[model samples]
Target: MLEKIFKLSENKTDVKTEVLAGITTFMTMAYILAVNPSILSAAGMDSGAVFTATALAAFVGTLLMAVLANYPFALAPGMGLNAYFAYTVVIGMGYSWEYALTAVFAEGIIFILLSVTNVREAIFNAIPKNLKSAVSVGIGLFIAFVGLQNAHIVMGGATLVELFSVDGYNKLNGVNATMNDVGITVLLAIIGILITGWLVVKNVKGNILWGILITWAIGIVCQFVGIYVPNAEVGCFSLLPDFSHGLSIPSIAPIFCKLQFKGIFTLDFVVILCAFLFVDLFDTIGTLVGVSSKAGMLDKEGKLPKIKGALLADALATTAGAVLGTSTTTTFVESASGVSEGGRTGLTAVTTAILFGLALFLSPIFLAIPSFATAPALIIVGLYMMTNITNIDFDDLSEAIPCYVCIIAMPFFYSISEGISMGIITYVVLNLLTGKAKEKKLSLLMYILAILFVLKYAFL
Candidate 1:
């Protein structure tokens, strides 16, 4: 039955293929199953509640990707966006977690609205194909950046004296400014790069996963041999959600109700939402495109069927998370790993959904897996994502500007929205100046989006 459904002979997919795909998908994205709770834990929220929310979100989202879009894309609470949820909106912006949840809920609703209206499809068609690929790759780089920073792997560097420094530290400063920390981080990054090279050269299957596991194992053995200081919780795995602390959703929407809606009506929030929506939208599109390319699922009409259903699924997943107790529900890029493993169809997603469902019984095992071990996997994925940058046509400066702007500005601006804003504005300005405006894929909605960025950035 499984063989018949996946059409292994046609797609060369089989039980062994599904299991391999499932395992690949699992290894790449296993970090996500844990990352959601870790970020939420920082907000002093109940870990138990966070774990429950994360599992439910992953199960629902992944199933939708598999069953709805018929793609191998995985889903989970988004990484960078959730950090922004915790750090920027909640803490930095002085909104409570509840308000943040409300914003997430709103984003999901907007996603659904656009999808159902088929406005979402129109936008996807309007975007340059390279932009779609770049957005996905850009996000991959963004997530990888987060992983490295968390692992203390990427450090600031200079030509002389310190060469590479940790946290912008310099040795001439003081006693605590010793070079040991920087040394370790550089060493790890180097090993990671070397492993990546080895994988590329050998064309090894599961290179990223294998490299990550190898690095983690090395780190573990180093600790055992008394050569390394361990920052990880090294231990045996336990499979079950840690529901020790009672779970409760934060209720902060009343605060927004009490506050003036004056700012909300302004272009700032709207622009931000548009930016978020665009990234989320394109990210989903690229995943679908890439997976479709692999699975031979593209329609003869040169479109993906049930794409609207997939969008609605994502939007609903976000809403489900906000209510059930987590952050935004974005589709997982790691699901491509499943496709690579032989999961050509939704049955693979079904298996993943089942795993996530059972995960509620085993949250401890998931959480116990340290970020450092997972960091390696993310770094490798980032490398894959970085390859998309090459697709940008540099000979034509018009399209080149937005591509470079979005890529460079995302990490610099520290908000994907701001980066996208810069990209849009740059694109518009470049088109007008270069006399390529006629050739532009201009839409009324896009013009509104560009105008909003200027207002929000300059005046608001």
Candidate 2:
């Protein structure tokens, strides 16, 4: 049946290799199980509920990708997108988590409409090639910055970045930096990064999963030795699980179907919605092209067969994710791991979906994996994404300036949407000013989007 459905022989992959590849892909990205809840909980959402939502969304999304798209990709609540939902929309904008979810749901529906109309393809092509690469690199930098902050590897203050100091006692002064201003938390994070980085360099499969497990075990030992504290406010060392409940189902009632449509109609909300829409649109396209290229699925013209089906799966996943109480669901670039492991068809996706479903039962134990342990995975993934920068042509100042701004703005401004908006605006304005727009023959939609983005920043 697997061979019949996935055409394993035609794809030159067998069931066993596909299954192993699926597991490899899942292991490479499973840090989402721990990291999503940690980030969303800051926005006042229930941590346990987010954990269940994240897993269930991945299961359903990956299954949809398998059955509908016949691809070896896995879907999850995207890392940077989740941070935006929690930090930018809910916390920074002072909106309720429910309203933030509404934006995502609305964005997803629009994405579905665009995909069905094939308008999304036009927009994807409208983006300058260099800017597309820059978006990926910028998102990578943003994710890495978040990981460093989560691990307390970079001290937070008014400065853009800084190091911890063994200064005062209370929160007013600073976190108590230990052992010559270098604490156990810092050491653990460094060790995790070194271990994971080395594994990746040595071409080890499941390197990220191994890194998280080893770091988590070391943290547990530190807790037993009284070096790692459970709930510290300032520095790292929060290794304890907040709940001891076992085997009970997580309640999604607080978040499920709680989207606020009325709240999504405001000017700021509309801007926010546009941000989600564009980010998801480009992110999905980039990942599809990238992973397919690695799998040799792209044609000589760089076109991916069955791309519409893949994109539809992503659009549906985003809609479903919002209804299930999480962030945007999109194809993970970590699917490259599965492809490198020799997965070539839908069976690999099916295997991953099954694993995601099984994770729901292990939520009790997995939720205990702290942010510090997972930080290394995010940083490593970020570094992996930076490879896309090589695709950008840096000789043209018109392209290079926009790409540079896009890459730097994501981490500095703390929003992927902000980076994308600024990049598009800069791309259009600079090209037009330099008389290159006519030579390049910029798209009508590009000019319109650039104008809209300018208006959004100026007034909205």
- Please tell me which predicted candidate would have the highest lDDT against the true structure: 2
- Mark the regions of model 1 whose C-alpha exceeds 4 Å error after superposition: 1-20, 35-51, 66-73, 79-97, 155-213, 229-267
TM-scores, one per candidate:
0.78, 0.93
What is candidate 2's lDDT per residue for 111-159, written digit by digit as tens?
8888888899998888788888898899889889888877777865557
lDDT of 1 by residue, 220-288 (tens): 565565455532222212222245643333232322222222345545456545655676677666766
Question: Could you give the C-alpha RMSD of every candidate to the true structure, in order shown?
Answer: 5.7, 2.4
Candidate no. 2 TM-score = 0.93
User: lDDT of candidate 2 vs native?
Assistant: 0.84
